[model samples]
Each structure stands twice: as structure tokens, then as C-alpha cells.
Target: MSQDPGLWTVLLAMIAGAIRVSTPFLFVSLGECLTEKSGRINLGLEGTLIFGAMSAYATAYTTGSPWLGVLVAGFAGLSLGVLHGLLCNLPRINDVAVGIALMLFGTGLAFFFGKPFIQPAAPRLPGIPLGDWTGNPAIASALDINPLFFVGAGLALVMAWGFKTTRWGLIVRMVGDSAAAARAMGYSLGQVRLICTALGGFLSGIGGSFLSLSYPGSWNEGLSSGQGLIAVALVIFARWNPLRCFVAALLFGGAGALGPALQSIGISQGYYLFNAAPYILTLLIMIASVSPKRSLKDAPSELSITR
Candidate 1:
């Protein structure tokens, strides 16, 4: 009773899926890249992401403004980032441990507060009609684009340039490379790390907003699906370069879109397994990137994962 989609249709569907799925990955990896550049890590971004989704949905539902929801989500993430930074700065504090704790705390808080708003519908973000001129319903639907993807792409370019040309970029790299050297240059280690981590959280929060406001476009406990944690590996896969992070996110997004793409062409026997592609790719990347002989060439010297 149904006609099969052509090869081109399937390819187009995957491309669309990649564009839609990669936005969150792009934002999260960039956030991690910035935080790690300043010699800190925020594992708690997972929690920040979930909480941001809930808050964004709640705000959009209440105020009838999706943009306002996105803003609130970023600030919510910033607050969590600040908390993680402060706790990590205490004497004998371990960044990894602090991050894990904050992750749990943030997740718990989000679930507790996000209950009532679960059933309510929120205003969703609008999509750009990139394929409207095609005049084909399937093609147009496949090419419907979200504005956040462009924002994430633009931010990646700006971040890459900023790291190379800005004064603050110099400080973040200095601190990441050698805390002693940064101190000698009159930079406060805690201050630099704190600021970068907070900004990272802000970006990640915005990424989370994209999930609830766009793709799945709804808020639920299972909305994140561990994307926040996967993004940490994504940052490493990118080797701390903002531009590389962008590419890596697209790669991961493509892998994630594989199953649905196949399903679109009537290949459904291994659909669930196909969905595991991203995780498999993450594991492979970790294996390839790590070496017993030497650390990653571009890894921050002061980064705990490297040291």
C-alpha cells in the first residue's frame, strides 16, 4: 500500500536528521571546549541540560515566548556552572568529583520540579523553510531547518577565532597550559576557570533548550537521553578545537540519524541497533584518541582527563 522512498529521499532525510540532531551536540561540545580551555571541566552539564529543558518548557508555556524560555535556560545553566566552579575551587576539591555530584543534584532538582508541567503544551520554536522552493512535500519536510543550528555553527566559528585572536583567549590557554604560568602573569586561576565554566554552562543550557523547543519539541524526564555525557567524549574527539568540535558533532549526529534514515527506506529489522551507532562511535573515538605512549597532542596540560 506504500511506496518506497528513493535513495535520494533517504539521503536527504539523513541529512536533515543530522542538522536537527547536531545542534545540541554542537553547543555542548563547544561549551566543554571553552571550559577545558580554561583548565576546568563540568561533568554536571548533563544535569544543567535536563534542568534547562524543563525550565525552558515551563517558561515557554507560562509566558507564551519561546525565546524567553531559551534565555531562562541559559541562565539556569549558568547558575549550575557557578555552583560547580565554586565547589571545585575549595581546598583539596577534585573537579571530577564535584562535577559528578552536581550532575546528580541538578538531575534530581529537575525531576522534582518538572513534574507538574509534563502534560502541558509549550510554544515550540519555529523552523526555517529552507526547502520551500523544492515544491515536494517530503523534500520540504526533510529540509525544514532550525535557526539554532545556524546559531551553533556561527558560534563555533566565532569561538575558534576568539581563541586565536582575543586577549581573554590568551589567558584561558595560558591557564589551561600551566596554572603556575597564569599565576605569574597575575591571573587568578579560580576566577578564570569559574568564568569559563559558567559560560560553558550557558552554552550547554541553550543546547538543551533546542531539544525541548525544536527537535522533539517537548519536555520530559527522558528528553536528554544522556546527550550531555556523550558530549564530554565529543569534546575529546574534537581535540579541544572549536571548529573540530563542530565537525565532530555533525559526525555524531549523522551516526545518530542513521537508524531513522534506514527506517525511512523500509529497513526496520535493526532499527534499535542502528540507534546505537553514536555510542559505538564514541567508544571507538575514545580508544583511538587515547595512547599509552603519550597524551592527546592538543589536550590541555592541566586538564584532569589528560593528567
Candidate 2:
């Protein structure tokens, strides 16, 4: 019946870490979900995520307002999304190629503009102490939830609802499932996709805000850690469902937290392996989720055609 304080502490750290780390994944995966639902793949989101991180950090440093930084990040994401959409519309242009190019472009731009703000202090996002009632410092620390986390959660609900009940969602679904059907119904395929891509990028930009303003709380050249690309795989693992994306984000977050949680308890033997847990888990999930039938059952027809 003896209680192991170290185990409890590690658990608390992981719980808190999961909540903190999952925010960006939630936002980016949701954004990618929307983009793919519109039958377009935006690999450029990796670049957008980095750009948003730099933009948010720099804006917060300059303006002394984290919220303003968040807003600007969203605008940056929108701009990038629009650019991707526009470029993809050109005849014979591939979205994946455009996305890779944009990824480099956005990262380069962020690094160029972000150099000066690297060491500057930026405003931090507010957090709600949900663990205050627990009377345990570890628990309290773990439960300090960011407002943006709630925002992303709310967005997931709205997205799920919209996909099931809203007209706009219907239009997006139609465009994704059948470009021919959409065209027959007078919907412009390019326009619908452009709007979805922009909106998706906007959300992704918000995800970037969470990274620089909340967790690591700094502007740096190597901030993103490939979260955007991972989100693409995350969307696939979630089977294109918004709610599933939310849950999957948390799962990935927990995996990411495993390393530090172990290290806190002095488990240094496999530190790198623990750090790599998230990527390994992502790979496993992708492997498990792949259909042996050679058909992504829930994938949009337009996306298949584009690929």
C-alpha cells in the first residue's frame, strides 16, 4: 500500500505536459483536416506553422500583446494558405510540390524576419489553474490550462457539428467527394478549395501561436519540430474526422510528454528513445490505420484524383 512519490510526480508531469503539448497538435491537425476535407493537401502547412511561430513571437515581443500576436499569426496562415491555393489552381501544378516550396518559403521568411526577436522577451498567454482545488502543487501545475486549448477544443466541436449539419460543410464535402458532382451543381471547385485552404491555414497559424507564446515561449529558428508534417499523418490516423483528430492530438501529446516525464524521474538510459516516442507512435498509428484494401475508405474522391 506504499505510495511511490516519484511515480505520482511523473504522472502529474505527464498529465500537465500532455495538456500543454497537445494544443498545437490539436490546432494543426484540425486545420489540416479541414483542408483535406476540401479535397486539397497542403504540405506547405509545415512552413506556415513555423512562420506563425515566428510571427507570433515577434509580434508579442514588439506589441506586448500575446492576443495580437495570435491574430497576426492567423493572418499569416491565411495568406500562406491563399498562396498555396492560388498556385495549385494553375494548370498542371501539383499541390504537394507547391506545398513543399511554400514550406521553404515560409520558413525562410520567418527566419529572416525573426532574427532580431530571437532573444527578446514576448508576452505569454494566460492559463487557467484548474488544479487549484486539488491542493497539490504538482497537480495544480499540471492542470494550468491555456485559453487557446479551450479555443481549439471548441473549434473541434464546431467543426464536427458543421461537417454533420451545416451548409458550408456540405459544400466542402461535396467538392471533396466528387468534383464532377460539385461542378454539376454550379460550385466552382477552385473557389471552394481556396476558401477551405485559407480557413485551414488560419487555424494552423493559431496552433503556431500556442507554441511560441505558451509552451517554449521563445522565437527561434528551429521551433516547429515538424509538427505540421506530422499533422498530415495525424489526419490520416484520425480517418478524417474532426473529433477523432482532437483525441488523436491528445494521444500524440501524451506520447511527446513521455520522455521528459521519464527524465524527471532519472530514467536517462533511453532518453532519446523516450523523446522519439511520439514519432514512433505516429508511425505505428499510420501503419495500423492503413487499409489493406488499397482504399482510404473515408478519403475524399477529389483528393484521390489529385494524388
Candidate 3:
């Protein structure tokens, strides 16, 4: 066996892994944030994420353009989101139940169609060589960042600013906070939710594209590993703030990197256990953040969980 790396190497690897692993979380959380802010919850994002991955990989393999794959994935997600929105808009429909059914439906579709592409090679998204100047191979490799990471970060900033300043942002907030008020103000509640949910699905799809086209760089049924579902909890932990969602994503990414970082330094005995860190952290965060007495102050009044 090869010798173990030094402490510095482990830390550097963890940092790199955090940046890499967090991209999907960031995108998914942002998507969920947008959806919930519009007074709707989408548990179906798990299906959307996996289906997006399959579609992106298949499209990239066929078209020989990873960017096109990304675009297609977003549309795939939008289609599912639209379905969800339309179903939920029906009289007396429950958003949560509809979302769950869609999640299973989406996953089934991805699994059925994705089997063919599992063994084929697909073009992957290119990364920025940020560490080229470092003069160290390992450091350089670690710093080779993906462009989508930057895009996600920029999106978070835009969302944060838009929520407090833009007209669309105010409308979403109004619709989410009080449906009756939104109706009184001449806004259509169903329309706002449908639009936001579709947009959220688009973002989630892009995040899935990153998974298949950038990091793992492959098509597989198990690619998502529940990141889509976990993002819902992440949104709650973030208090629905886009800026805080970004930070929360990074934190979860760091937790996820812990196992691999240790393994890189020859600590592989409990590797699988270490990999469970993210889920454990999620549980802890939810426990600490949730309360039975008082509701979250920043939670939308019309949100189902909050009620």
C-alpha cells in the first residue's frame, strides 16, 4: 500500500472536496428556497434531480456537447415542475402528497430510460484551472474548480438581492405570506406558485447536470444519494434566506468531505460511517433548529409545515 499523506494534504483535500461536493447542495437548496418562498414545497425534487442527471448524461452523450445537456436537464426539470404545479392547483389538492407522488414517478422514469446510458461514455463539463499557478500537482488538481460552482454562487447572491429589492420578489413573498392578501392585491396565487415551482425545478435540474457532467462525471441511477431531499431540510435550516442557504451548503459540503478527506490520509477503517456525516449533521441541525413552542419567525405564514 502507498504511504499516507500529511495533515496539510488531508486538509487541502477536504477543502477541495467541500467546494466540489457543495455545488449540488447549493443549487438544490436555492431551488427549494424559491419554491417554499412561493408557498409551495416540492419533495419531488429528488426525482427531478435524478431524472435531470439521466437526461443530461444522455443528451451530452448524443450531442457531444455538455452545455446542451445542462440546458436539456433544466427543461426536463421544468416539465416535471409544471406537472406538479398544475396538479397542486386543482381544488382541494395537497401540495405535499402531490410532490411525493411526483418524486416516485420521476425516479421511475429516470431508472427506466437511464439503463442504456449507464455503460456509455459522455462528455463532461470542463473545469477552470484555478490552481495552475500553485506549482504543486496536488494543489493544482484540488483547485481545478468547476464553472457551475461560480454560477451557483452568483445565483445565490442574485436571489438574496432580488428578494429584498425586486418587484417579482415582493410578489412571491406576498403570495407566500397570505393567499387571501395576494388575491385582494389582484395577484393570482396559483399562477405565482406555478411559475416559482417551475423555476425552482429548473435550478434543481441544473444542479443535477453538475453531478453527472462535472464531479462524478457519469450516469448512474444512484447518483443523487438523496441530496435533493436533504435540500428541503437545508432550506429550513437557512431560514429561507438565499445568502444563508449558500453558507449552509458549504457547511454541508464540508461535512460530506470529511470521510474522504480522512481516507486520503489512510484512515479508511470506518469509511462508510464517515460518509454518513452529512446525514448525521442534517439530523442534528433539524433537531436544534425546530421547536414545538414557537414557530420560525421568518417562515412564511402560508407554508404548510409552519402551520
Candidate 4:
């Protein structure tokens, strides 16, 4: 920490960047939170992320409106989510395999369409002022401060409340915890999973859109480097709670931004090592979440992936 700058400065930068960078994770993880809570996994979000980025970029460029691009990206992601749901409903189509296939398909599709736009920049998401507390320009400069960051925060609050107080959240949780129990209650597993999967895809696609059309503001082959997978990992770190997801996204976001922040302050500090922060932290969280035997006992009983 000292090699880069003052600890507080680094911390400040991390907090700010975390808000911006973590928006994608917040969106994707929260969506996965919903999917996993429904006793299903959509590893295909990795693909959705890339596809959404490409779709969003193309739409925003063609129409000259980034917001529209975001919408298109969500719909594109929903299509994949629906496909995953439909396939998973089939007798022998494993969800994991479908997810991997989607990842390849989405990435390939993104690359094919993204090649032309690689050199162009799209309009970015609008930003709101929340840094009035500081008189220093450095603080403001360190954080891009996008509107979606706050949207993500607000979303967490809404989702957390909904899960606790709404009938749908309860039913989804029930379905995830015990399929037999959910079936006993006359709930259609296929319907619930499909709806939830589509919703998840929509959210994940928006997350991907945020990366290309907002924070990063450009398209390239390396635009996203495993953020989708890290977000899936974030689901476990967050313990299936939307509120925890907000915090965890910021934490991972901070880790991800550390390298860039250091570089901004004239510190390289083994860029490769710092770049691994998000992945390393994710692995640690997975180990902790899985190591505790009691967590499983407390987890949704029908979650086969965790079991």
C-alpha cells in the first residue's frame, strides 16, 4: 500500500472506483442471486456479459443513444437466459454444459460484431454528483461516478426487501430450497426457473452493457476479463443476499481497481499481481464459504450445485 501512495488515498480511490467498477458485479451477482435462490445456476451469464457488451455497443452506435443500447443488451441477454431455461427443462441437457456453450457463443458473437466498433467510443452513462464532501480534485478524479452505481445500490435495497416481504421472493426461495416441496405446493418448477432465468439474463445483460457503454466506454476483445465469472463467484461470497451482494461487489470492485489506481498515481507495483486482486479475493471467499460445513446446512436444500 505504501509503495503506491498514502494508505488513505489508496483506500479512497478504491472506495470510489469500487462504486463505479462494481456496478456490473452488483447487477450480475444480484441476478445470479435470484437464479441460484431458485435452485438453478446460469453459468451462461459469462457469455451473456460479452454478448450484451457487443449488443449494447452496436445499438448505441447505430442509434446514438446509450440507454437504448442498454435495453437491447438486456433483451439479448434475456434471450440467452430463456434458452438456458428451456434447455435445462429438457430431460438430459445439463445446465452447466449449456452455460459453457453460451459463454463461447456469446463471446464469439460479440467478437464478430465488436470488431468494427473496437476503434470507436460510445456515449457513456450519465453521472450524478455525490462527491461534494471533498474539496480535493484528486478524489473526484479518482472516481468516475456513474449513475448506475447508485442504481445498483438502490436495486440491492429493493431486492433485499422484496425477498423478505414479497410473496414471489418467498415462493422463489421455496422452489430453490426444495423442488419436491415446491412441487407439493403446486408450483411449476419449469415456469419458475424459466421466469427467474430470463430475469437473471436481463439483469446480467445490463451489467455487461454497463461495462462497454458506460465505465469502459469502448469495445475490444479484452474489454471484459472474467468479470462475469468473478460475479458468479461473488454470488457465493454474498451468501445469496442481495444486500450482501452490494457490499461484496464493492469489495471486489475495490480489488479490481487497485492496479489502475496505483498506476494513476505513478506506481506500477507489479501490475500483473494487482490485476489478480479480484480473482484472488474471489478464490478466498469461495474457500471460506465452502469450508464452513454449517453454511451448507443453512443453504437452500435443493441447490444441487452447492450440494
Candidate 3 vs 4: which has more TM-score: 3
Q: Per model, how many backbone clashes are there?
A: 0, 0, 0, 0
Best by lDDT: 3
Q: lDDT rank, highest first?
A: 3, 1, 2, 4
**Candidate 3 vs candidate 4, lDDT winner:** 3
Worst 10 residues of 3 by lDDT: 1-10
* Model 2 lDDT-worst window of ten: 288-297
Q: In model 4, how large is the Cα lDDT of residue 102?
A: 84
Instruction: Note the Cα lDDT for every prediction shown.
Output: 0.90, 0.89, 0.92, 0.85
Tens-digit per-residue lDDT, 101-175, candidate 3:
999998999999999999999999999999999899989999999999999999999999999999999999999
Provide C-alpha RMSD values for all models, in order. 1.8, 1.6, 2.0, 2.4
Superposition-based RMSD of candidate 2 using all C-alpha atoms, in angstroms: 1.6
lDDT of 1 at 77: 91
lDDT of 1 by residue, 1-307 (tens): 2443467867898899999989999998999999999988889889989988988999999999999999999999999999988988899998999989988998898899999988999999998998989899988888889899999999999999999999989999999999999999899999999999999999989999999999889999999999999999998878889999999999999999999999888789989999999999988887886783333678888988777
TM-score of 2: 0.96
What is the TM-score (0 to 1) of candidate 1? Answer: 0.97
- Backbone-clash count (model 2): 0
Which one wins by lDDT: 1 or 3? 3
